[model samples]
Target: MILYHTEPDSPVIEISVEGKITDHDLREAIERMRGDLELNGKTRVLERIEHFTGIEPKALWTDITLGVSVARKVTRAAVVADAVWIRASMHLARFFTKAEVKAFHVNELEQARVWINT
Candidate 1:
């Protein structure tokens, strides 16, 4: 599941993911982000992943394509996850995204929020 939090005229987008993610969920989230980018030109992202079991194969593909498509439009991305593998995956994702991507432990969510807001 994915939850998005954004306020009117805000340049920061907050997303929270839980459990398994599907291709539809990814596509919807990406589309919303694209719409925000169109209006804002550039934006920062704060993503929090909790109990993320995994994603479907098709979801992975959609994520890659959509992420690359909007790479240059994102200014910064802060990912908060406790899993080591998730952190490693964030590093790999950075190569495909233009945003400055950083991974934080769950305990450091406040710091991550500050970084993204800055």
Candidate 2:
């Protein structure tokens, strides 16, 4: 399950994932994010991965197709997770995405927000 929300009047999207992301959830998130990006021209994403089992193939494909331009518009990313693999992936994302990505442990969520907002 995915829980998505935004900080009002701010170009920040907060997302928490448990289990897997459904296509409906992905679409709704993309819509809101796209609207924000269109208005602000850039965005910051805060992803909290608690227990991300995985996303389905269709959801992955949808994300890929819809996220290309959206990804570029995200200028900052704050990832809150304790997983080594997620941190490693964030490191790799620096090379591929325009966003300045930072990873933090679950306890450091506040720090991540500060870093992303600054």
Candidate 3:
């Protein structure tokens, strides 16, 4: 499951991923994000992966497509995660985004928010 919320004070869009994240979740998230990007002009993305366990290859592909779409539109991307693999993946993928990608621990969500807002 995925839930999306917009930051009240900024153009940052936050997404929460819980339970199983399927390709459908990725697609829906991307669609909402695209709408947000168009509305915000200068966009930022915050993604929180809390109860998300694993993603399938189709989901991964969707993720890449969404990331690329965000890269073309957003000013920054912040990801808060406890999963080591996800952190590593973000670090590796950072180079592709036009926006900066920063990964933080769940406890550092505030810090991630600061970075994205900045």
Candidate 4:
């Protein structure tokens, strides 16, 4: 499931993801994110992943497409998770996009939020 904590007035897109994700979930999330990007021009993101088991390949494709479309518009992104693979993936993302992507341990969720907001 994808739980969004987005504030309409804020430029930050805050979301929490758990369990397996479907294309519907991903598409909905990305659509909201796109709206934010359109409104703000530049955006920041805070994603907290917990017990995330998997995601459909189609959802991955959708995420990739939509993410690439908004990549240049994202100024910063904070990913909060304890998974090593997720953090490693965030590190890899730095090379592909201009955004300053940071990964924090789950315990540092507040720190991540502060960094992203600043």
What is the Cα root-mean-square deviation between model 1 and the actual structure?
Answer: 1.4
Residue pairs with clashing backbones, model 2? none
lDDT of 4 at 53: 97
Best model per lDDT: 1
Model 4: runs farther than 4 Å from truth? none
Number of the candidate with higher lDDT, 1 or 3: 1
lDDT of 1 at 72: 62
Give the Cα error of residue 103 in candidate 1, in Å: 1.1
* Stronger candidate by lDDT (1 vs 4): 1
Candidate 3: segments with Cα more than 4 A from true spot: 65-67
Order of candidate numbers by TM-score, starting with the best: 4, 1, 2, 3
Model 2, 6-61: lDDT tens per residue? 76688888988878888888888888889988877778999998877888888888
TM-score for each candidate, following the candidate numbering: 0.91, 0.90, 0.83, 0.91
Report lDDT per candidate.
0.88, 0.83, 0.81, 0.86
By summed lDDT, which 10 consecutive residues of candidate 1 come out lowest?
A: 88-97
Error of 3 at 54 (Å): 1.5
Report the error of model 2 at residue 61, Å: 0.7
User: Going through the candidates in order, what is the number of backbone clashes in each?
Assistant: 0, 0, 0, 0
* Model 1 lDDT at residue 27: 89
For 1-118, candidate 1 gives per-residue lDDT tens digits of 9988888998999999999999998888898999999998889998999899999999999877776787668889999987878887886765677799999999999999899988
TM-score for predicted model 1 compared with the true structure: 0.91
